[model samples]
Every structure is written in structure tokens, then in C-alpha cells.
Target: MTKRSFDQFFKNPRHWREDLVAVGGDFSVDRLLYAYTHGIFPWSEDPIRWYCLDPRAIFDIHRVHFSKTVLRKVRQKKFRISFNEAFPIVMQACSYREKDNTWITPGFIDGYLELHKKGWAHSVEVWNAENVLVGGVYGVAIGKFFAGESMFSFESDAGKIGLFHLFAKLKESNFELFDTQQLNHVTWQLGAYEIPKLSYLDRLERAIKDMVPWVIPLSHD
Candidate 1:
């Protein structure tokens, strides 16, 4: 299968929720990886229509905030976090519709599962005391960077546990950056801020050159 070239996304990466570059392109694993490596991603509100976004706002590792509430929850140890253990399950869970709608369509799941199989994508799962999976965050990882896709929680603060562990582990492993893609109310609360596209691309260029394997240290508990 021939994947679409990244050049087709746009000539410039600096923009704020402007417009779709191209729609209806195949979401091939190669294509998806290429998009992420180039700081572009596919977002579809209706699933039938996909837009490629290159956001100015991104999450820096130093800026990923933990509020007092989130900090307290992380301290509670209510969930056990694991990585790449149950990606298919977590992907399905992230795609599950808690609200009236969802963008994680069948197409999206199949494409990402392929990426996961190739080790270009990964997930961090949070399990409950009973060993049931409660929350997870899945994203594409190229080299030293992780671009977060979606996170879902079955319990309060479950998703935060997964995220906290992900950030902690990445920092320990010498990872360079985590791209949350767009800045919104949700991402803002998580400490994502806007940078010029030139600034981000410079960092991304270096990040994608270094390899930092996804690893989660075993909990002594």
C-alpha cells in the first residue's frame, strides 16, 4: 500500500485550528507515523471527515502540570500502571463512547493496532486492585518522543495515574518530548502551551533522532 507523503499535509506547521489540509486519505501505519514525525495528525469530529492539524500549542515535559488534587491522587497508589501489556484492550477502551459521540472509529482503531504491532505505538494501562484495567493512554512514539492520542478512565484519577507514570518513566529514560497535539481547555489544564511552529519543529527534529524505548519500572508494591 502506498502511503501519502507528509509534504501533502502542509508547507507550514504553524497554525491554530485553522482548517483541514486534506481529508479522506488512508490512515496507513506508515502514513500515521509520518504524520506524527512531521508534527501533524488526523482528527475527525465525525469520523467520516478527517482533518490534519499542526498545532502551535504543545505539551513540554517540564510543563506537564500536576495540581494538588492530581498530586494527591497520584500519591494514593489506587492503581497499578503497566505498559504495552494490553494495548488492544486499552485501544478499544479508549475508543469506547462514554459521551454521546466518539472520534475513535473502526478505521482509527485498525490503523493504530497496526502501529502498535510495529512497536511505533504504545499504551500505558492502569489497573485496579482486582487487576481489572481502569484507565490508559495510547499514542504514537517515534524515537524519543511520544504524541498522545487519547486517554480514558474508568475511575476518578485513573487516567491521571497512567499519565503521571508515563511522564515519569519517559523522563527517567531520557526521552525528549511529549506532544499532546493541540491546546484546548483540557490540555491547558494539563500544562500544554503554544510555541511557534518553527520552535516545535526544531525540537521535534532532534527528538525523533534519539531512541528512548518505552519502559515502566516494576512497582515494588
Candidate 2:
């Protein structure tokens, strides 16, 4: 779809009030980037539903908080932290971790795998001392904006550790936005908050205009 048509489709007033704004589109790299850059995202498959939440949730990068315990665990370095080392594995783990309901279907995985190849998608992986994959967080980055897709953990505090590292990197790299889509318990505890959709769209517009490199080392020492 052309950029003009895609923008026109989302300009409908109905998209402003509703969470599920539009439906039926492929999760192509261009489509995904367009959606995220415009504050919209794909939530489900089987025809593929697109959504833009009314009260969008995001982390104010510098304000993200980690409890003393999590901070200490991070300091202990019991788990290894790495960026983009296990994109597909992390995405698949998030999909199956919630067996009853998962929006990360095969199509979604395929789409993001392609995005990763193009350097627009990334994953922060947490591995135990035994080198076993225990937790991870994955997301898409466009310019200075990052939209966190999902996270999963096999061990206690593992996911939070990965998340902490991601936030650190975003702040270090001077990112402007860290969109979390919606508020869940984990995000709430970590200081994710909501803003009006229009306000989020405004921020997103300016954020994607500037270039901010994702410059973290592939492996954390």
C-alpha cells in the first residue's frame, strides 16, 4: 500500500475512539514500520487486526524504575545480557510462554524476523550462567522511537533484568520514545504510564524524524 493510502485509512475518526482501529493487512516490514511510526500496531492474526489504543502506554525512559532487589540481581550478573543474539528464539519463547492466548503467531514471527534482518527489530536476551536462555524482551525500532512488542522469562526476575538493560540502552542512545502499547502488571511496576493517543501520535511524529543509532554491544561484558 502507498503511504498516502495507508495514512488516509487511519485518518478516520473512528480510529481515534477505538482500540481496534482497522483490520485485514499483511505484517510486511513496510506495513509494520508504517504502523509503528504512526502509533498503530498489529495485535492478532487470521486476517490480521490492527490497533491504536486511546490511552497509549509508554515509558518515560529516564523515569523507568528498578527495585533494589532487581538492581542487586543485575549487579550480581548471575545472568548474561545480550542484544539481538537470539531474535527468533526470544520471539518464539514469548509466543508459547502464554499457551492459551498468544498474538505472536507464525505470521507475526515471520514478519518480525524479516524486520530484524533489516535492522529495525531487536531483542535483549538473558541467559543463565549455564548459558541457558532464561528470559528476553523484543521490540521494533524506527529512528529514535522504539515500540516494545513483548517479553518472556523462564526464571524469576529474568525478564525484568532484560527489560532494565533495554531501558538503559534506550536512554544511553538518546531515544525519544519507548512505547509499551498497554499497561500490564510488569510494566506498571516499572513505571509505564498512559497518555492520550493524539499526544502519543504527536510525539511519535517528531521522534521518527531524527536518527538515533542502536549502538549497544552485541554481547554484554
The TM-score measured for candidate 1 stands at 0.84
Please give, for residues 1-221, the per-residue lDDT of candidate 1 as tens digits: 33344565443354435545555666787667666766777776343344434435677776688778878877887777788999888888888885666678777888888988878888999999999999999988787888888898888878877888888877776778787767878779988887766677788889988644455456655
Which residue window of length 10 is worst by lDDT in model 2? 211-220
**Which pairs clash (backbone N, Cα, C closer than 3 Å) in model 1?**
none
Cα-based lDDT for every prediction: 0.75, 0.87
**What stretches of model 2 exceed 4 Å from their correct place?**
8-15, 211-213, 217-221
lDDT of 2: 0.87
Instruction: Identify the runs in model 1 with alpha carbons over 4 angstroms from their true place.
Output: 1-19, 45-55, 211-221
